[model samples]
Target chain A: MKVVVTGGTGMIGRKLIDSLLAMPELIDRDGNMAEVTAITAFDVVAPNPPLPDDPRLTIVTGEISDAEAVEALIDDDTDTVFHLAAVVSAQAEEDFDLGMRVNLDGTRITLERCRALGHVPRVVYASSVAAFGGNMPDVINDTVTPNPQTTYGVTKVIGEYLIDDYSRKGFIDGRALRLPTIVVRPGRPNKAASTWASSILREPLAGHSAICPVKEESKMWMLSPRRVVESFRHAQVLDAVAWGPHRVVNLPGVTGSVTESLQALSRAGGNSARARVTFEHDPFIQEIVDGWANTFETARGLEMGFKSDTGLDEIVNVFLEDDLPGQHVYYD
Target chain B: MKVVVTGGTGMIGRKLIDSLLAMPELIDRDGNMAEVTAITAFDVVAPNPPLPDDPRLTIVTGEISDAEAVEALIDDDTDTVFHLAAVVSAQAEEDFDLGMRVNLDGTRITLERCRALGHVPRVVYASSVAAFGGNMPDVINDTVTPNPQTTYGVTKVIGEYLIDDYSRKGFIDGRALRLPTIVVRPGRPNKAASTWASSILREPLAGHSAICPVKEESKMWMLSPRRVVESFRHAQVLDAVAWGPHRVVNLPGVTGSVTESLQALSRAGGNSARARVTFEHDPFIQEIVDGWANTFETARGLEMGFKSDTGLDEIVNVFLEDDLPGQHVYYD
Candidate 1:
C-alpha cells in the first residue's frame, strides 16, 4: 500500500511518519493487513532536519492548494491519505485570504483529487477543538454544534462536513478527527494562540524561561502528540460501519488549567524548572483562550477506542520521552 | 440602496422580489430605513413568466459560479445581496459535481466578490432545514449540531459557516436562515424529495391529480412562501447585535404530516381536491424524505421575531391567496 501524508514535515506529521515507518502495516480497503510498500510526504516545505533516509520514504514539496501538485502527489497506487496541512489559529485570524486559500480551498483540492482517483482511499483528515467556540455549553459533548469564531476553526469545521459528504457519496472512505490543543509541542512556539499551552510546559522542561500569557486558572482541552498519532492510526483501521455515516469525531482529551499544568511541570522538572515559568498576562490571548470549549465529553471517541493523555503530567512526560531529546538539535 | 438577489427567478426568490418592490425600503448598514433605488435579479435562467416589469427590477441571466459575472452583478453600488442560488436536493444528489460547483464554489465566489468591494454588504443567505439530518433528536432545537445527510444539505450548512465567517471578519454583514420545506408550491414538481410536500396540495388545488410518494404519517417541518419572504425581510432588518457572532438561525416552522396537509387541502378545495391525491410510494424518494429533520424548535428565530405559518391550513391558504392565480398563467 502506498500512503500519502500532507503536512508531513510538521510536528504531528513528522512523528506520524516515524511511527508509520517503524510499524507500517496499515489495514487496506479490503479489510486486510497490507504491507506499506511506499510512503510519500507532501508538504509546502522540506523537512528541517530531514526525515528518515529509508528508501521506502520519499519527501515532495509544493503548495497544497495547487490542484496539479496534489494530483501528481496522489495517484492510483495511493491506499490512504493522512491530510494534516493547515494554517494555525492566530495566523489564520491574521491573514484571512491565506487561510481560506490553504485551509478551505486546499482541502477541497485534495478531496477532489482523491475522488478523481475512483478507487476509494481511506482519508484521515485533521480537524480541531477550535471547531467549537462562542456561547458554548459548559461541557461540550458530541452533540454540540460547531459555531467557530475564527477563520481557522470555520475552515476545520467545513472540512469535516466535506469529509462526511465525500464519504457518504462513496468518493472516499474518510475520517475526520477534531484534535484538541496539542500540549508540549516540541521545538519553538509558532503562531497558534494555544502555542502558550505548549510553551509553558516545553520551555520550562528544557531549562529555558517561558511566558504564561493567560491567567493560571485559564484552562484548555489538550492531548499528547503520541496519543494523537495513535488516534490517527486507530481512525484509519476502523471499518466504515464503525464510523457510520457521520465521519467526524472529536477525539477524547484531558482538560487542565495552567495551574494544573504547572503542578505537573513541577512533578517532572521540579521547582527549579517550574520556576522558569513567569506570569505576564496578555488579555488578548486570554480573551481568545476564554472563548474555547475547554471541557468535553468525547463519548464517541472513547467508544471508538481513541485515547487521550491521562493528564497534563502524562502529556509533559510524552514530550520528555519522545520529543525532548531531539528538540535542542533541531531548533537551537 | 441597491440590492442583488441570486436565484431571483425561482419560487421564493420571485416572491421575495415582489415583497421588496412593494416595501421599497430596507435597513442599511447605518441602521436607517433606506429606499431601495435599484434591484438586480440574477439567476442561471431567465424567469419563465418573466419578473415584474417595474423600472426598478432588472433580471440578468448568468452562472453564479462565474466569478466575473458575480463581480459585475454585485458592484460597489450594491448595498445588500440575497444569495439564494443553489442546486436543489434530488438534482444535486444525481449530479455531485454540478452541485459543488454551483452551490459551494458559487457561494465562495460571491463572498469573495463582496469582500473585495470593502463596503460590507448585508447578505441574507438562504440555508435549509436540510442542514439537520441523520440520527436526530425527536425535536431539533437551536443547539443541535448540523449533521446533514445529503450533498444538498452539506452545501447549505457549509454556506451558513461561510456567511458567519465572512460576517465575523467584517467583510460582509451576513444572516443565514435555515428555511423549512416550502409547501403548496405552484409550479410542476421539481427534483427535490420534498417537492411532493407542495405537489400533494398544489396539483390537487389546481384540479390536477398528484402523487403522495411517502406514507401519510411522514411529516415535514414546513413554512409558506409568504412567510419565508417575510422572514428574509425580517432577517435583513434586524441589527447585527441581534445576530451576535453566529449569523445563522433555524427559522420558525410548523411540523405537519401528509395526512394533516391533506386535511388542510380538503378544507381549502373540498373533498374533490383531497380525492385528487393518491398514495404511490417511491422508496427512493421516501427514504430520502425519511432522512430529513421533520420537527424543530426555533427559539432564536422567534425571539428575533421571525414567524411561522399558523398551521398547514394557513400554508394552503397562502398558495391560494398569493401564488394560485399565477400558477396556471405561468405553467399551463
Candidate 2:
C-alpha cells in the first residue's frame, strides 16, 4: 500500500523512511506481508534523506500545516498516513498562540482536508509521552490518570481523541503511538529541552564535548530512534482487540537516572567519551527535567507484541555503528 | 472562606450550595480558619436558591462562559471556585455548536479569568467518566487511557487540562473530579440519556407510570446524589500531597446491568412500583445506553477518601421522601 509520512525531515522521520525503504517484513494480522507500493515523504522543511530517480519513492516538500500542501499529499488510492509533524514542547509551551496555530489548527486543517477527500487512510499518529504529566512516581501506571504538565501534552492527548473519534465514525483507521524521548540521534539536535540527553551522549561518543544541562540525578524515559520506528510500524498492524477503548498505547522505553546514563557512557566510551561530557545545570531545563515523568506501565503494549531496546548498551551499539560519522564511536 | 459555585441553579448545584450554607464547621483548611465572607453562585439560566437576604451571599445571573461574568465571580477574597457548569453529553453531542460554545468556551473563559486574578483559589472542576471511553470491557479501570467515544467527552477532557494547567502554573489550586452519573436524583431529571435509570425507578416507586427506553441487559455506572455531594466535599479538602500526580480522580459508583437495576427496583417498590414501570427501548436512548460505560477501577478514589455508593433503594427513598411534588401526577 502507498504510505505517506509527515515530518519526514525530522531526525526520527529520516530513519523511519530508511526503514520503509528496506522493505522489512511487515507483520499484519494475517501474518507477514512482502509488499508495500510506495512511500511518500512530506515535510515543512527539506526532505530528510533526499531520494532521487526512484519510481517507488516520492519526496514532496512543503509546509504540512498548509492546506494546499496537505491537499497535494492526499490521493484516492493512498492507504497509509503517518502524521509525525509537530512543534517541540519548549516552543509549544512558550508560545501559546503559535502552538495553537501549528499544533491545533494545522491538525484540524489536515483532518478537514482528509474529510473533504472522502477517502480514509490507515492513519498512524505520532503522539508523545508528554501526553502524561504532574507529580509522577517512579513508575507511572496510566491507571493513575493523566494530569498534563504542559500544553504539548494537552494537544497530543486531544489529538489522540480526534483520531479515535474519526476512526470510530469510519472516517479513518487511526492508531496513535505515544513515543518516549529518542536517544542517540545523529543530526544537529533541535531546541527541545530533552535534546541534551542525546546530544551529550552522542557528541561525547563522537569525540566532541557535550554539556549536560540538567543534574545527573535527574532521570528521563528514553528509547532509540530505531525503537521509535518500530513503534510506528507496530501502530500499522496492532490488533483491534488489544487496543480496546484506547487506540493509543504507551510505547516502552528504558527509564533511569542521568547518573546511570553517564555510567553507561563511561563503560562504553573508555575515558575519552566520559571526559567530553560535563554537567552544567540550566534552571529552565532543570525545571522541566524535574517535572518530567520517567516511568510508565506499558503492559498492554508489551502484551500486544510491541518491542523495546534491551538496555542502554543496545542503544549505544546501534548509534555507534550506524549513526556515527566515521570514527567507529562504539566506545573505543 | 469565599467560594464561587457555577451552574448553581441546577439540582445538584442548589443542593450543594444549601449544604455549604447549612454546614459551617466544614469550611476550614490547612490549619487556616477561613474568613467567611461570601458565597457567590452564578448560572446562565436562573439564579441559585435565592440566598438574597443573607449578607454573605451573592448571586449573579450571567453566563459563566462570559469573561466579565467570570471576572465578577472572582475577587480579592475568593478562596475556592466550584465549577459545576456543563451542557449534558446528549445535548452536547447532538448539537455540536452548543457544546463547543458552552462546555469548551465557558471552561477556557473560566480558566483565563482564574489565571488573570493572580490569587490562587481552590478550584473544584467537575469532570465525568464519559471522558474515558471506547469498546468498554465488562469492567474498565478509571485509568484505561481515555479514548473518548464522543464529543462531550472530548470537551470535558479539554476542560480538565485547562484547569490543570492553571493549577500547574500556580495560578489556581485546581482539582478535577470525574464524578459518576448521579442516581436517585432528587429533582425533575434533565434531558441526559442516563436520566431513564433514575426516572423509571423514581416515577414507579412514587406510584406513577414511567418509560424505560433501553433493554434489560444494558449496563450503566451510577452514584447516589448524596455520594456525589460527598465526593464534591472531599474534592475541596484533600491534601495536595495526597493528590500526587493525579489532580483528577474517578469518583466511585455501583456498576450493574439494567436487569439488576430493575430487579432492585422490584425488590424495593413491591408490586406498585413494578406495575408502573414499562419498557419501550427507544432506538435513540438505546444507542446511548448500550454505549455507556460503568465499570471503573475506582480503588484510587476510594483510597483518596471518596465514599462508595450503589444502592438504588436509597436513591429511590431520597426522591420519595424529599422531592416528590405535592401532586402525585408530578411523578407521572
Per-prediction DockQ, in order?
A: 0.94, 0.37
In order, what lDDT does every prediction score?
0.92, 0.74
lDDT of 1 by residue, A82-162 (tens): 999998888899999899999999999999999999988999999998899888889999988898989999999999999
Which has the greatest lDDT? 1
> Candidate 2's residue-wise lDDT over B1-332, tens digit each?
78888887776787777667766333343435455567888888766235546676778888766887788777766777788888878788777557766887788778767777676667888888887665556677655656567778888887777676667667677889887777777555578888888877777767777888888877777887767777787888776677765577788888766777777788878877787878886998888777767777888888988876646666655566656663255544
What is the docking quality class of candidate 2?
Answer: acceptable
The chain B TM-scores of all candidates, as shown, are 0.97, 0.91
The collision pairs in model 1 are none
**Candidate 2 lDDT score at position B203:** 73
- TM-scores for the candidates: 0.97, 0.76
lDDT of 2 by residue, A1-332 (tens): 67778877777777787788786444322334546668788877776245444577788887766888888886765667788887778888887656655676567566656556566666788888887666556687655555567777877877777777666655666788888888877776568888888887788888788888988788888888888898888778665556665677778888867787878888889888889988887999898877778877788779877788888887787777778863343445
